[model samples]
Target: MEYSKKTRSSPRTLDLNHIENTLSIILSQVEEPLPTITEIAEQLKINRRVLSRHFPVLCHKIVTKRRHYMRMSHLAAIEQCCQEIKEAIVSLQQSGEYPSESRVCELISNPGYFRYQQVRLLYKQELQSTLSSL
Candidate 1:
């Protein structure tokens, strides 16, 4: 005469078209940082494994796109840091001052750029050029 009251939760429904559209929108962005597949799945409130299973190709594309974007962004940052170092050295030379590492670090927009090996090499080359020309 007693009845159980337990109810099972229903599985989530996914709209494949909506997921594709959302992914399209994200991929269309030129400047925004690309999200990883896990991030996309989290944003869509789906489990990562489920999303990967449902959209394996899209997931792969997202990973590739993110990789390319990250590489380009890093290259751009390196170029910018090199340019900043070059400008700082030139300014110091024009002002009749030696471009010491400390002085260059103070003049550049980001002193942290010195951590980059590429920037450091460019700085050394530019310094050598300046010294040779004097």
Candidate 2:
């Protein structure tokens, strides 16, 4: 009696050029946030180590893009918060009330906006401007 051995097929090879093109496309999109290397690797059905080893530049770009996006998002939020605080101050003054921190917190969507130094500085500046104008 002769026994036959079953052979295992090798994993499919990845197209490095195709992966680079796909990564470029993913990075080029303005609306979507950049994904982490792990996330991208998972989406591509490849191991993160393999992806990083094959495309170090793309991995770096993704990290850089994510950081930039986060910074811009944070700035936008601070801008919105400052605008809300300004509006709230005006509204309070119009209604014959002082714009205290608690009052401003009550007026804005995020009560914790005051926790940020930028937001606090803006609040103080606006308050001073209002007082000086009086």
Candidate 3:
């Protein structure tokens, strides 16, 4: 956040670039392993209340963006897990092995419990569809 060591020419001089950079730093820290605003202000050598006063909009934006990003990340991970589970199920079926929950778990590395349930449901549906087509 402290972009430079040089003192500002005037205490009242509002450097928009400096403020923007500081806001960026603040937002970047909003993810997991977040630092407190007081710590951030101390690191930037500014008063916490003053920083909040100057960047209320940026603070709100950071909170919103962080929440959205976290949700997206979580959804992506869940989708990936589901895909992996499906692939594992197909592989097990091809190998003439039953795709039981334990077998599916063994086929995939560090499979999640909920994902395994989803995989079981998907495998059953696929088997039922295949049988109905026969």
Write down the TM-score of every candidate.
0.80, 0.81, 0.56
lDDT of every predicted structure (CA atoms)? 0.87, 0.89, 0.68
For model 3, the stretches where C-alpha displacement exceeds 4 angstroms are 1-21, 24-54, 113-134
Per-residue alpha-carbon lDDT of model 3 for 65-89, expressed as tens digits?
7667777877676667667667876
Best by TM-score: 2
What would you estimate as the lDDT of candidate 1? 0.87
lDDT per residue as tens, model 1, 1-134: 98788788898788989988888788777755798888988999888888679778877887889998899888998898889899999999999998999999999878997988888999999999999998
**Candidates ranked by lDDT, best first?**
2, 1, 3
* Model 2 Cα lDDT, one tens digit per residue, 1-134: 97768678888899888888878887787864788888888888889998789888888888899989998988999899999999999999999899999999999998787889999999999999998999
Question: 1 or 3: which has the higher TM-score?
Answer: 1
Q: List the residue pairs that clash in candidate 1.
A: none
Candidate 1 residues lying further than 4 Å off, grouped into runs, are: 1-8, 28-32
Model 3, TM vs. native: 0.56
> Model 2 off-target regions past 4 Å?
1-13
Best model number under lDDT: 2
